[model samples]
Target: MAQGDMRDRPRHAGAGDRQMTALDPRAMRLANAETVLRALYGADALSQAAIATATGLSRRTVELILVDLEAEGWVRVRSTEPHASGRGRPARQYAFRSEVGVVLGIDIAHDRSTVAAADLRGRTLHTAVVPMPGEPERAERLAGTRRAVAEALRAVGVRPGQVGSVSVATPGNVNDKGAVDVELSMHGWTGVRLAEEFAPDFAVPVHVENNAKLAVLAELWEGATPGADHLLWLMLEGQYNGMGIVMDGVPYRGVDGAAGEIFWAKGLGLDALTASPLIGLGRLEPEERRAEATAILERAERGDPAALSEVDSFADVLARGLSALSWVFAPRYVVLGGWLAWALGDLLATRVAARMARNAPPFVAVRRSTLGPDAVVRGAIRAALDRYEWTAARPLAPERRPSPVDGG
Candidate 1:
C-alpha cells in the first residue's frame, strides 16, 4: 500500500494499549463487541455458538454483545429453527440488521447522472438515471442529481432520515475532505463543496471522490478482480480518459488526489498517444455518441475495415499508456472500463494486449470491465459503505462511541 493509504487505515491496538485495555473491563467489552460486529457485518445469519467460535469469545460474552447490538438496532434475530436432532429448544439465528439504514451513491457526469441506494452490505436496492439535455451549470447539474437521488430513495421506500452516508463520484481531483480541488468538465464546478451542498438534504456524512478512482474501488470490491491488491482501471470514455490505480489494496491518491489523472496526456507531449478516436465520438450528443460508438464497435467485430482501423488506433494509444503504467506500478491486472471499452469488448483488450506484449510486464493481465456505464455509481455506493464502516460504524476504541444519528 502507498504510505498515505497505509497511514489512513484503522490501526490495531498495540501491545501496550492491549495491556491497558485488558485491565479496563469496559474497554475489553468494547473491543469484544467490535470484533463480534465485524464478523457479522458481511456474513449470513449466524447462531450465537457460531459467532462465539468465529470470534474466539466465550458463549456468554457473545450473547451479551449480540443483545446489546440488537438493542442498538445493529442486529436482529433472523429465524428460529429446530436442531438437527429435533431435541430441546430451537436455535435462533442472529443477523446484522442491514435494513437499518441505506447509503447513497451519486455519479455525476457531463452527459448524464446516476443515483443509487444500497444497504449496509453494499447491495444496491434502487437506482435512477437522469439524462442532462444540454450543458448544465453546477446548480442545474446538482439539482438534477438531487432529484434522482430522491426518486431512487422513494422507489425503495427509504426516507432521507434513513440514509446513513452519501458518496459522490465526479470528474475532478478530490481532496481528503471530499472537496473538489479541480474540475473542468462542468461549469462552476471547480470549487464546489459537494459534501456541504448535499449535507442539508441527508444530514449525514458525505464522501466525494474522483470518478476514476471510485471506478477502481468498484472493480476491487465487487467486479472482476475481487482480491487483487494491485490493479489499474483505465477509463476510455468520451473526453474522460483517465486512470485509477490501486497498490496493495489501497488507492494511490497523490498528495493532491491527482494520482491517476491520465486524461491530461496532451499536456505531457503525448498527443499521438491520446484517446482521440474515442473523444471524437464524444463530440456528438450523449445518446447519439453511445449509439454511434456501439455501432462502430459492432461493425469492427464484423471485420469492417474503417471501423477496425479506428479501434486499432484507439487501442494503440491505450496500449502505450498501459505499458507505461504497468512498468511503473507493476499492477497484477489492468482493467479497461468506460463506454468505449464496454462497447469494444475483447477486441480492444486483445489489440492492447498484443501491443503491450513486447513493452509491458509479462505477468500483467489486461481485462475488459463488465460493469460498463454503471461502474462509477456502483463505485460510489461501495465508497459510501466503506467510509461509513471505517468512520461511523466501527468505534476506534472504547473512548469513542458510534453515532446514534448516523446509525453507526
Candidate 2:
C-alpha cells in the first residue's frame, strides 16, 4: 500500500493521546503489539521509524513488537529499500503476512447474498453471489445462506476450520446480545440468532451486524471516506432504507441498535413513501419492477424528460428520508451505497445532497460510495479479519473459543 492508501484509514481524533485502552500489564503489551500490527496492515509496508511515528511508540518498542510479530508469522520483512533522501543506509520494510490465514465476509441481502474471501491486507481474492429464495420460513432462508457461504468459501479454497473468522451483514438491528430484533422487510428474517446458527455450522467465530453498519465499516476501512471522523451512510435499496453512523472511527450503535433507522421516524412519514410503487414493487419475485426502474434510469440517462421526471420523484423520496436523518445526527460526511447507488449514479448523490443541505449544517459533505456493490461483503471481510487478530491475541474470550463439540 502506498501512503495515499493509508489516507483511506479513518483519522485518529487525538494522535498523542493514549488511544489504546488500559489493561493488565500482559494485556497492555498484547494490545500494543496489536496496534503495531494494525499500523503495518494499514501501511502495507512501513519502516520501523514510520511505524513508531504513526503509532506514537518509540522505535525500540516498535522493533520489539515487530520481532514478536515476525516470530508469530503475523508479519514479514519485505525489503530494505533506500529512500531518496540519500542520507543513510537503506531501511528495512515490514508488512502483515498476506497468506497467514483467510477471512470470509458474507453479505445477506433480501434478494441475493454475496460472499467474499480476503486476506488481512484487505485484498479481495474471490467473490460469489447467489440468488436468495423467496422463502418465508426463517429456518429455510438461513439454511440457504449457510449453503451459499459454504459453497463460496469452498470455491475459494477455504476450509471451514481454516477460516479465521466470519462476519455477516443483514438488514436488521443487531443488539449487544447478538440478537437480531429489527424487522427485515425481506421475505424471511426476524429475531434470528445469526451468530449461534452460523457459528456451529461454520465452526468459526461469527460476528453479525446490520448491513448499513458494515457499509460504513467498508468506507472507513478502504473507501472514499477512509479518514473521515464522523460519517453517515445511507443505503438505498428496494427492500429497505438502511442507514449507519460512525463517530471517531467506531460505529455508534444507538440504544437497541437502531441508531440510523430514520426511515421509521413518525413525522417524516417516509415508511409509506419507501414502500410506494416506485421502490417496494421492485422486490417482487419476477423482479419486473426492478426491470422497469432500470429502464427508466436508462431513458433518463439518454435525456428523456418523462423518465427524468420519474427519477427525480424517486430521488426526492430518498432526499426526504435523508433529511430526517441529517437533522438527528448531522454527520460530517454521508455516503450513499446499495443497488440504487449503481443504478442512479451521480443523480442519486446530487439530489440527496441537495435535500439534505436544505436541513443540514453547512459543513456536511455528501458523496457516493466508491466501493460499489462489494461494500458490504468487503466490510464483513474486514470485520472478520479484525476479529481474527483479536482472537489470536486472546483466544480465551468466550466469543473466540470454539463450541464444546468443536473441541474447545
lDDT of 2 at 387: 69
Instruction: Give all candidates' CA lDDT scores.
Output: 0.75, 0.71
Q: Quote the positional error of residue 55 for candidate 2 in Å.
A: 5.7
- Report the CA-based lDDT of candidate 2 relative to the real structure: 0.71
The 10-residue segment with the lowest total lDDT in model 2: 399-408
lDDT per residue (tens digit) for residues 50-143 in model 1: 8898779999999998888878777778878889999989988987666666778899887778888877666677778888767788889998
Cα lDDT for residue 342, candidate 1: 75
- Superposed by TM-score, candidate 1 places the C-alpha of residue 59 at a distance from the truth, in angstroms, of 1.2
lDDT of 2 by residue, 284-400 (tens): 425676667777777878989988787677767767766666666777898888766766788767877887778677778889989887888878877776566442532222222
